[model samples]
Target: MNTLNEINWFPGHMKKALDQIKERLKTCDGVIEIGDSRAPISSFPTYLDKLVADKAKFYIFSKADLADRNALEKHLDKYTALGINTLALNLTDRRAMQTLINRLSLVRTRQEERFLKLGFPAPSKRFLVLGIPNVGKSTLINSLAKKKKAAVENKPGKTRSESLIKVSDKVFIIDTPGILEPNYEDKNIVIKLAILGSIRNDILPLIPLTDYLLEYLLKHYPQRIYERYHVSLDGNCEEIYLRIAKERNFVSKNQSDSERARSTLLTEFRNGLLGGISLDE
Candidate 1:
């Protein structure tokens, strides 16, 4: 993998998005911060610490279906213990989605009470849906609205602007473009995001990322890899890649197609084919 100096993870549009978020946040009642459940801590933007400082905050660990249950529970416990309102949600599940809407409804009620106490008329509760790129921010917005209010895609930077989405008469959310911290310097976090498909694939080489994934699986999820590809996890990542290549018949010009094998491995893991794996652990 290249050094941080060699990569431009924070682009121009992201800076614009951050400015837009700051401008819009003045009117928002609370923040709905979403992050990937598989990597709750790393996926949550560090920049948001100041952005959401005094606001009523609700944290959503999205894509819970793709995360290991034990790891997810640990994260949920940590946040809940901190007195932060949090939920682990599989966005596609209607029951789970309804639960989120219900929680937001409670937020709205509390917001109304606070406003009324201040002698102001109860106003609509506005929330800013914030997170790093492709952590299902738009998908969560669509689910809350009970329709396709925001564009949904598997890749990063799909939503280039912020838009107001009405979930109920009294509850509104702003869907902003996913933005990473401008000075984010964690290479491990970058690798995790790349493996989870939150970062653009071309920004970093896939081989090192795959090696990291293989090492994690070998330590914590060896059974999953063996079950999926019938390849033994008895060797280094290069050897494992070769074994997977030979097993899957990923060959080109009488050589193992390591690139193809790496890409496939990443796709399968991202799509939850290997199992419910969590990178944060």
Candidate 2:
């Protein structure tokens, strides 16, 4: 097995965004940490804990619709046990979004109490939203604000700066660009984030990633591969890819197009065609 020695993806825009976030944290009432529910642990911006430890913190694990129900429930349970305010659900669900909005009432009340004690008028609640790359921070903000206030993209690093968008008359959210640690301490995290589309796919070798996904699915979700492609899960990753290539007619000349097979496998997983998958568990 090949291990990634290092993955340093911190760009110029990310540094600038971090600086702005630190400066603006003083004015914000709370912090909301967002991450992909499919790989919540890996996709999380764990580095932000130190920065937001002093403020009211909430965890919103997005894309819960695509995460394995059992695994997601377990993850949520662990967070709940820790006494951390955490929510795991689809970002588009209106009811879930309402629950999120309602939960923020406590944070807002606390901010107001602080302001009153300081002899200042209570200001609109400001929440600093932070997440790793491609974790749906903008989409959550858009859903909360009930409008297209932030740029929603499927790729990473789309939002380069923080934008204050009013979700309601008394609530404002500062959507910051997806920020990643300069380097991940665990290399497995890099692979997991890459598979979850939270990191750039081009940064790693495609074959290794595809193999990792294939092995994981075979072990934890063999039925998905069998049902989706009718391929036997008894073989190795290469054999499985070849079988899928033949099944999908991904052939080039006399040989199976392994590249296309790998790409398709990854795409299927990302789009949740294979089923609800949880890479974190």
Q: Each candidate: how many clashes?
A: 0, 0
Looking at model 1, the pairs that clash are none
Per-candidate TM-scores read: 0.94, 0.92
Q: Which stretches of candidate 1 lie over 4 Å from their true place?
A: 108-113, 118-121
Give me candidate 1's TM-score against the actual structure: 0.94
The lDDT, on a scale of 0 to 1, for candidate 2 is: 0.84
Residue 98 alpha-carbon offset, candidate 2, angstroms? 1.7
In candidate 1, what are the lDDT values of residues 107-182, reduced to their tens digit?
6445688888999987888899999999988888887778788888999999987788888777788998999876
Residue lDDT tens for model 2, 192-226: 88888877877788999899899898889889989
* Runs of candidate 2 exceeding 4 Å displacement: 1-3, 108-110, 115-123
Best by TM-score: 1
Lowest-scoring 10 consecutive residues by lDDT in candidate 2? 1-10
